[model samples]
Target: MADIIESAGVVLAYGVAGFAVMALGYLALDLVTPRRLSSLIWTERNVGAAIVMSGQMIGVGLVVAAAINASEFQRGLGVGLVSTLIYGLAGVIVMTLVFALVGILTPGRMGATVLEDRDGRPHPAAWVQGAMYIATAVMLTAALS
Candidate 1:
């Protein structure tokens, strides 16, 4: 039916918008961290970096998911997309601030704590930071809900 096709188009548009926002969130994260995430995780085989990256990805995903689900798209596709973008950007900013503040509060340099590889052995702090990021995302999403 034409209605079904139109609905599908709307869904597709929403998905595209969400993913674009998520990519921007990742870029913001890349800017905040000292090391490049893709290299640290893929090339270096750094478990600690991977852990932190995982948390960040999930956190950003949560924000994107929340925005897509909660936005005023039902009012109209354009309105919904714009609202979702606004929410997603806000989430990214908030998460970045959380990361930065926590990084500062932690005892050592942020990069050192996150990319802790000594003789290829990972440090405990890396995991702790990862969990904190996840917790921040969870709390943020819940608050937004």
Candidate 2:
């Protein structure tokens, strides 16, 4: 029980670290670009959204892989390699589903919003992302153990 608890904590910590790193990277890119992200994407909301979400997909996969590594010290390397690849593919599918759903729900908003929306709203895309996340987590857990 204690081992499981510790493992969970480690995984969560790794996810936080990954998220922080990814956010910082995005911020740096924004500073360097110095242009409206939408403009760069030809003002196509869907295209810009896809590009941003693609980064998010990679970031989420990295965090998931890191978390899996934290959970298994001995076999972390093997599991990390496998999970990273699986999560990368899963992220692409999940992000595509997310952007599509967002386009449906918000109509014109898609990638137009300048501010972030992190409210705990019941979104279909969130559920999809969560499902993919959990499934990948479980696969890594099983592979390690």
Candidate 3:
């Protein structure tokens, strides 16, 4: 019980820190770009922001998991490698489901605003972000249990 509580606290701390870092990245980008450029790229910029946030969250989660699972986290290199692959595959599937569900439920323009490219193609960075999420999940699962 105490271990679970401690682990939760660590996860919460990591999550908050990750969010702060993501916000800083967005602020920096906004400050560096001209107003006109910012207006033009606002949508794509938000997408980038989302990707950055996702990476940060996963990175933080991995670190937190490592710290929390230090004693029982001995899965060896083989387990680590396998978990990475499995988590990555699961992450891709989960991401796809999110996209599909959003598309089905939301109205067109609003959906577009939430996330979309001018050309209607999905962003490449989504895949990269998904991999990070998956990798973190894999590491956490192996380490925690």
Candidate 4:
């Protein structure tokens, strides 16, 4: 039906917007880390890098979902997509700023500490940093909603 096709189109548009935002999030994380994020996770098989990246991606997804939910009904599809993109980007910026702030407050660089593996295991700092990203996203999601 025409309605089904229209709904599919909206879904596609939202999907593209979400993907673009997530890509930007990845780039922001890459900028903060000491090494190339892709290389660290893929080539090096680094668990710590993987954990950090996973957390950030989940956080971005939550923000994007919240944005779409909040805007689609109230503002319609076009505004929903735009707001999702904007909110997702904001989430990335906040997460990056939190990373930097943690680095400053902590004894050593947060990024460097998170990426460290000790005795073939990920450092505890990695878990803490990863949780911080999720927590930041939750707060941003609340603000969006």
Number of the top TM-score candidate: 4
Error of 2 at 75 (Å): 15
Candidate RMSDs in Å, in order, are 1.7, 10.1, 11.6, 1.3
Q: What is the lDDT of residue 44 in candidate 2?
A: 40
Model 2's TM-score against the true structure: 0.35
Give TM-scores for every candidate, taking all chains together and pairing residue i with residue i: 0.88, 0.35, 0.33, 0.94
lDDT (Cα, tens digit) per residue for candidate 1, span 1-145: 9999999998899889878877887787778778897898799898878877777778878877888788897798999999888888888788788878887888877766778788887777777766776777778678668
Off-target runs (Cα >4 Å) in candidate 4 are 72-76
Candidate 3 RMSD to the real structure: 11.6
lDDT of 4 by residue, 1-145 (tens): 9999998998899899999999999999999999999898888888999999999999999988987887654667777788788878888899999999999999988889999987769988888888999999999999987
Please rank every candidate by TM-score, starting with the best.
Answer: 4, 1, 2, 3
lDDT of 4: 0.89
Query: Pairing residues by index, what is the TM-score of model 4?
Result: 0.94
Better of 3 and 4 by lDDT: 4
Lowest summed lDDT window (length 10), candidate 2 = 114-123
- Candidate 3 lDDT, 1-145, residue by residue in tens: 9999976875565445434433443343234323332453454565533553455346444543443344222565345434433443343344334444544665542223333444544455444444544465565456445
| Candidate 3 C-alpha error for residue 66, in Å | 9.3
The C-alpha lDDT values of all candidates are 0.80, 0.46, 0.44, 0.89
If both were scored by lDDT, which would come out higher, candidate 2 or candidate 3? 2
